[model samples]
Target: MSKTALITGASSGIGKELAIIHAQQGGNLVLVARRADKLNELKQTLESQHKVSVYVIAKDLTNANAPQEVYDEVQTQGITVDYLINNAGFGGRGKFHERSIEDDLAMINLNIVALTLLTKLFLPDFVKRNSGKILNTSSTASFMPGPLQAVYFATKTYVTFLSNAIAEELYDTNVTVTNLMPGATESEFAKTSGMEKQVYLNKQQRHIQ
Candidate 1:
């Protein structure tokens, strides 16, 4: 039977690429993102091209209740998620003291709390069934302190550690957890984080120019 994957942040960036890959492999999808339009568009494209079912859930994962709501919705739809890809997160570029507290909190909520909650909600079912895979989108920033993007880096550290610990816990089971630590890539992340003007990006731009 073809598997089903639930992918958050499915509207754009790496999350979007993951969805396409799963579809190409003949797997069904539950695509979650705040942008319904983009989700629908991807759903149409993937379904037409790959003949896989795609369900879109537009939600802001920063909200405390969003993760639970997503879980409930999946249950209501009678979808058994075979793969859980927690790829929804954003970063803000600024010193910890200068950045907006609200933004930082939202980052924590989405990057840390939402990922943990979704894993918590889904892993039990995986354990009960003795099969499932979890792929979390952590970052290279997890390794060290980020001078400007402090909270973002710290949140990624939490993700890396949490994912590692849980993988160890499930070693006896068929379930698996993988953390992806990608460096700077061509994605919405740079623009969303306001890092387009940063030195590295500027240097890259100059080279391209």
Candidate 2:
């Protein structure tokens, strides 16, 4: 049977790759991202190549109410998201104290706050029916403190712990939570996070969305 997956940050990077993988398996998709153009582009390619339905929701998840609005819109559209993949996040490389507070806050909003809200919004449906899955795009940075990217690491730590806790909570049910900590990739992340000029902290640099 073909399942319907709703993935955030589906415009690029791991999220986009995940969408492609799912489409290849004949699953329908509801892709959420700030870039409608990218989402539509992916939608067209996936629909043509895989013969699966693609729905695009363009909203900046950094906003406080975006998560709720997204949930409402999904409900209005009568889309049943069988899988929820929270994969949108960014990091800044610099001393925590030296970095701009606004930027750090935005990172928290996207990486931590937005992810949580989306999970909260969707997990209940999964629990109600004793099915569904959640895949959060955390990082290995969650495992320890990151000096240059302190805030980013902290947010990921929160995601890891949260996913674990929720997984345990749903042990009696069929609902499951999975956390992904990618090693490295070559993406627009380094350039956007202001890490391009810095010495590479880890070997096998990662691709970002």
Candidate 3:
């Protein structure tokens, strides 16, 4: 049987690509994102082309309750998720003290709290079945302190550490956790982070993995 994957941030960027790849492999999908229109569009396209079931959960994951609601919804649909891909995140480019506290907090809530909650909610089921895979979309910024994007870098550091630690914890089981650290790529991230005008963005080349 084809596996089912529940992927956050499936509206665009790396998340969208991951969803496409999974659909191409005949896997069912639970796509979660804030943009219903985009999610629906992707769902229609993927279902038509790949003949796989696609469910859309349009949600702002920064809300503390969103993770539980996603888990509950998945249960209601009786979808057994074999893969959990946490790819919903954003960064803000500014001095840490100069940025709005609310924005920084929202970043933390989505990047750290939401991801952790979703993992907590689904991991038990994976352990019960002795199978599952988790892919966390971190960033190359996790390796060093980001002067202009402090909170964003810190949150990703947590992601990388958390993913690696959990992978070791599940060493004896079939469950696996993988962390992907992608460098600058063609995405809305630069514009959303207010870094589009930065000199580094223009000069930096996309990292080839």
Across 30-134, the per-residue lDDT of candidate 3 in tens digits comes to 999999999999999999999999999999999989999999999999999999999999999889889999999999999999999999999999999999999
Residue 131 of model 1 has an lDDT of 99
TM-score of each candidate structure, all chains considered together: 0.96, 0.94, 0.95
lDDT of 2 by residue, 5-109 (tens): 999999988899999999999999999989999999999999999999999999999999999999999999998999999999999988988999999999999
Pick the lDDT winner.
1
Question: Rank by lDDT, descending?
Answer: 1, 3, 2
State how far residue 9 of model 2 sits from its true place (Å).
0.7
RMSD of candidates 1 onward, in order: 1.7, 3.5, 2.9
lDDT of 3 at 167: 96
Cα error of candidate 1 at position 54, Å: 0.4
Candidate 2 has its poorest 10 consecutive residues by lDDT at 200-209
Q: Give all candidates' CA lDDT scores.
A: 0.95, 0.93, 0.94
For candidate 1, write residues 119-209 as lDDT tens digits.
Answer: 9999999999999999999999999999899999999999999999999999999999999999988888988888878857678888999
lDDT, candidate 2, at 23: 99
Best by TM-score: 1
